[model samples]
Target: MQFDRKGLSDEDLLRFYLAILKPRMIEEKMLVLLRQGRISKWFSGIGQEAISVGAALALQPDEWVMPLHRNLGIFTTRGMPLHKLFQQWQGQKEGYSKGRERSFHFGSGEHHICGMISHLGPQLSIADGVALAHKLRREDKVSLSFTGDGGTSEGDFHEALNVSAVWDLPVIFIIENNGYGLSTPVSEQYRCESLVQRAKGYGMEGVCIDGNNLLTVYDTIKGVREYCIREQKPYLIECMTFRMRGHEEASGTKYVPPELFVQWAEKDPVKKFEEWLLLEGVLTYSHMEQVKASMKAEIESELVRAELGGPIVPVTTEELEDVYAPVPEVGTDKDIETVRQFSTSRPIRFIDAIKEGLKSGMEEHSNLVLMGQDIADYGGAFKITEGFVELFGKERVRNTPLCESAILGAALGLSLEGFKSMVEMQFADFVSVGLNQIVNNLAKIHYRWGQHADVVVRLPTGAGVGAGPFHSQSNEAWFVHTPGLKIVYPSTPEDAKGLLLASLADPNPVLFFEHKALYRSISGEVPEAYYTIPIGKARIVQEGSDLSIITYGAAVHWAKEYADQHPELSIDIVDLRSLLPLDYDAIRASVTRTGKVIVLHEDTLTGGIGGEISAWIGEHCFELLDAPVLRCASLDTPVPFNLELEKNFLAKSRLATTVDRLLRY
Candidate 1:
């Protein structure tokens, strides 16, 4: 019943025992709170405490731990105040997340821990980024990420492993193979003999161990830490264990077999570890009693303090806060003019302008890294980053695999590790591959944890001649609908460069849509230096009083051409640069002056940015309007491969006709 101390002192062993008991005591109290309806549901890590505590103990103070919802022992081991943990459960403003996120979805920058998200697999890739940042900075600190057996089935798991292996990042991916991923068992999750064996495919070392054995868990992590640091590579440790309690407080044990629970009860990590300590004479009977009493008293004290603190009152103004970081004014008009004067002033393609902006950003900020599929060697699908790898080197301009989820997830991690990342989706249509990470992880991280996820996703969008459906599509509407995301679809070369620079500077998740059709077609003078156009500001491309055309990206060029042909109609063109924070002031000024409006876009007619603009005008500017609002966009069907059909699908003729109809109305 005794465990070898190995190199750990008596105090270290006692500290480990305390780590396991603290979370158990806290979880038991929280379960009571849940039953009383004073708190929300609780995810109890009753049996799996040893794994969290042991691994946390093995890591250095500066090392980061991206814990899952069940790893409450990690917080206890890291010296997080017990009252803050209870305050978070009570939804108090004093907690780590300031009552924004209840439960375990919180992280502390001060403690070098990442806040957990419900989707478990994405954290692996984020941990990889953190590890990568440590490697880039020449720091020996490692990142430990935890996930369950069910999470391994997620695409992010494979993506994280692959990227970490390929880059040789100092990350330890710990898979707590708890018998079930909720109701589904490991047998149903994967057909493999063991999850650890899968790590070989990624060319990394893997191991399986008895997770409940606290000494084995601690020793293994200690060795793994040394190996990862010495070799500068990722390691996967599959800790075989069981989730003794129900998935959550609301979940019943009806799905679990009584005999299986009885079997696991015998192997209860806390009981096993306590008996070992008693038998080894590390603790006498009185000592054990004192330890239990101390933990109980501590929990009671924290609970009282948390109850007295009360819950945060919901405020209308607080809800609007922390949407995006305040945009920093980099320079004045005179500084911008000076930048323009110093550089070679020449006309460049829209795509080239974007490349210049990226170059300027990298030159200015060493922390900025570029990542995408074929961006390094192939220069991307469109040659945007052709000479980037040679200029910035492979370390900064990385060539990632076709794993979009990891690309975004890792970008978030890099951002958290004090680096700004610009991620490129090979094409706009392919962004759907990583939509979960983009919508859930990237966009919501800043809002949830008050952390800056400074990531800019450059998407090549829109269809013109014959690029078919998959390669070409305007998907800006999908992101615009998502809160906490800034959408920028620039129409001109100057705006493309300026807006991209601005997106890079902003400390929020920005989806920068580069119109593929306008990459080569649009050519204009662009500033050579880093001059950012303010995000959420719409540019008035043309001035008129007859009618207004609110459009962006490729449609802006079409609107300009149409306006030129029709001299009788004094059309005002409002090119919306940023979609999320829509420029209502400029939009209202143009719409009120014209009294008739036509909303245009390249996305599908049904459910597009055009619809949002039309609805807002109808609601707010209805009295100012002389006629009804009209919209001109692509057909609901997919983009056709044929040149003629594609042109007809997003025809300038259709837009011109819509403008005429709106003007006549």
Candidate 2:
């Protein structure tokens, strides 16, 4: 097991040779299958086998690695069963993702491997999370991820590098700079002389190595692994290699200069390594041919077994019968009364309630860590985590760089390690930068592979007080359409604290939207003891029989104000606490009683969540309604900074008029 300074032991040398042969033979057989129409696609790592094989052999079994599309060598070398891998590629039900996803998009906790998204750069941030978790656990383990020459241009790559470097996380970012990203040459990707030069910008160490040489890659990764564990920091390794084939089999190599292929052909990793082994007396031509034949037979047998896997079974439920995790609703009134007897109640602001709920979760579950920009000393952009360091310490209440995607990726890694994370976005609009991580990684992770991302993204959202388009926009509707995310927008302090507890309890990712305007403007009696409001439940702020005003977030108060002013018209106010798994039963009951409804929200009219509600009302509650269902929302325009323009854009008068019109009808 010991690695020698002078050379690898004869056994290790042979083992490495076998490791390289497996993926090489497997891919060769796969290409034939692809040509035969038995397989769908292939990302050939034909010439660059040394990078994945050497990296896998260098890493300890317990250390994690996020493999790229061409890195099947890492999976095969890590002892992942060839049969299951084939089934996965065939889109069979028995595969890791159960046919929900394709190729290397699925990960295995059993093999100490995390999957990569189609967006290659996000894996770098996910690797940061796994490394961060290992560091926090005091485990001397290094987590590594791979990207290509083209992926370095992505902001995720830079964000991940800066985060790992600044936080002193143990990670190795290996760049497979294989000449071209698809058809574009290295010259077109960036102006830097070499990708390794980027390490200096993030204040990290960098090195470039000859990737075609197996022993060189093995030795370099092994050395870097040791260095990262010893120094507790990130390192960049750019494996200078060439892509021998086209990016994928479907994409031909016509764009590549023929001379480049001729040049790289002489440096083929497998054949060259085999030649070296023959010269060193470690292998003979006869033995090499025999071993290769055996490998081919092994792959053939596994392919047959994989072909036996059945098609994806049909499911009647939504999103494969288990896309979203089950989040409990509020307890019955009797149960609620019992819970209230155990806790002291006091008036609290919406902002303070959120802090208390997070603090409570952190206190109860020691594995919970809060991460955001300036959240530690400054307590977050709105001072939500202010003074949290004194209670939870800097390690638990951590300050992150201004990289939302990387932070979200880290949350995924932490979730993998059984740690819950509270990720705070400074403002709601800023979430746009991290949407790839949220929409692709976190949102799809569970549905893709039955792997839960138990993280809460605290979105300080909605508009008021003239914060303008960028600061004040309501973006909850953006994620409501996303299947895997649970959207919670609470309007009151008590609901904010209680719903947060519920969000933390759920296994899936939850988007906890906090309206900035209501943070201090609203005050309510919040329980001192830990209590959870059910995720998919609506609160009836007031009960009436003439009209029902259904809304959530800041608009809940607007409906309450209008209802209080018009005492002549009895109004039923339904505040939707959870948007994704909407409390439709409550809405049905209210609309059936009132026989008329108006969907109100501060956001613009077209494409707003109100439209969805209005449509649902017309479809399901049409017979019970006395008049046509109406939607009261702001004009289809951005939130204005001018005070008077903003007041008119909010559509408060529109709600009042809609109520009177519906009543008259």
Task: List per-candidate RMSD values in Å.
Answer: 1.5, 2.3
Lowest lDDT sum, 10 consecutive residues, model 1, at 330-339
What overall lDDT, based on C-alpha atoms, would model 2 receive against the true structure?
A: 0.88
- Highest lDDT model number: 2
Query: Residue-wise lDDT of candidate 2 within 187-270, one digit each (tens)?
Result: 899998999999999999999999888888999999999999999999999998887788999998999999999998899998
lDDT of 1 at 336: 44
Tens-digit per-residue lDDT, 494-550, candidate 1 = 889888888898888999999888888889998776787888899999899999999
Query: Which ranges in model 2 have alpha carbons more than 4 Å from their true place?
Result: 1-5, 325-337
TM-scores of the candidates are: 0.98, 0.97
Evaluated at residue 557, the lDDT of candidate 1 is 88
